[model samples]
Target: MNIAKNMEAIFVAAIVIASATSFATAAVSTPVIAVKAEASAMQTVTVTAKRLTAAEKAAL
Candidate 1:
């Protein structure tokens, strides 16, 4: 009976550990695309300028 109880405890612990590892791996894999998207947006904005801004500056 004692051996059976020990085996059950170990099984539960293994499941909990496996769940934690899966979640950790998933967390590490995300967020790379968001960083790439932001970099592309910055590049696009840097290449274009609003010509009207010059006229506005002259009026000022």
Candidate 2:
């Protein structure tokens, strides 16, 4: 395959641009991921109340 010199340059530029975009995307999404993780963790606990005992259930 005969690749021109400018084609090599263009390929290099495209790789650099893709790398930069990947880094930018990772940086921007990190905090969003953290926030989502926190929200999911928070949601994991339905409530803090303890399960009612048989006696407690009878009292109700």
lDDT of 1 by residue, 6-36 (tens): 9989999999999999999898955665434
State the displacement of the C-alpha of residue 27, model 2, in Å, after optimal TM-score superposition. 0.3
What's model 2's lDDT at 21? 94
Deviating ranges (above 4 Å) for candidate 2? 1-3, 30-60
The superposed Cα distance between candidate 1 and the true structure at residue 24, in angstroms, equals 0.3
TM-scores for all predictions = 0.41, 0.41
For residue 10, what is the lDDT in candidate 2? 85
Total backbone clashes of candidate 2, pairs 3 or more residues apart or in separate chains:
0
Best by lDDT: 2
